[model samples]
Target: MEEFTQQAGPFTDAQQWWIEKIADATAATETDFAPKLLEGFPFSARGGTFGFLHDFGREAAINLLDELRRALA
Candidate 1:
């Protein structure tokens, strides 16, 4: 995740904000749950992927937050 943030740039304001939020949430999560929750999160913009929260857009990000909430529950 740090690699993606350091290497990727020029993201939309929304994308940037959500990515940081996601990173923060991930950091707050328990170590065991973090990996599973982020298992499919895109870490790079390779192979036509949008990378991280860029691919998630607003709705997906919201859904992911909900999932994270559920996991923490």
Candidate 2:
């Protein structure tokens, strides 16, 4: 995941900091679920796929929060 992030660029500063939030969300959501999904796949694929989803979902959710914060501000 870190390797992919390095190649992609852009999320290397403040945005990169938000990754903790994403990781937390992923851990909470997948703790029980990913095992089911990964049952037949290669063991190494787990981290990559989990990270991909975390980065995607966290960015999306934060984008949504922009409006809420604006309205509440």
Candidate 3:
């Protein structure tokens, strides 16, 4: 998580907010963290094509962060 906050740069304001929120929720061990995260980005295929693409990009960012975390660990 620290790795994410540190190295995952060049993020938009909204993306940065989400990243910080995720880190905070994770550190606090928020039980509903996943749900809250999803709620924050309520974009889906059913919503619109662009939204789906945006969500896909967000997922990729998350996957990259996870990979980084695992590699560091």
Model 3 lDDT per residue over 1-73, tens place: 6555566566666556555554564556644344324434332313333432364486765574465445344
Which candidate leads the pack in TM-score? 3
C-alpha local distance difference test of each model: 0.50, 0.41, 0.49
lDDT of 2: 0.41
Which residues of candidate 3, in runs, are more than 4 Å off? 1-3, 30-37, 40-59, 62-73
Q: How close is every model to the real structure, measured as TM-score?
A: 0.38, 0.32, 0.46
**Cα shift from native, residue 16, model 3 (Å):** 0.1
**Tens-digit lDDT track for model 1 on 1-73?**
5456555555566566655655665656644234334444443322122444356665665665565455444
Q: Which 10 residues in a row give candidate 1 its minimum summed lDDT?
A: 41-50
Ranking by TM-score: 3, 1, 2
The alpha-carbon deviation from the true structure for residue 21 of candidate 2, after best TM-score superposition, in angstroms, is: 1.8
Query: Runs in model 1 with CA error above 4 Å?
Result: 1-3, 32-73
Pairs in clash, predicted candidate 1:
none
* Tens-digit lDDT string for candidate 2 (1-73): 3553454445734436444343444455653223233223332243544444464466653452343233323
Residue 23 accuracy (lDDT) in model 2: 40
Measured over all alpha carbons after superposition, the RMSD of each candidate to the real structure, in angstroms, is 11.4, 12.7, 5.9
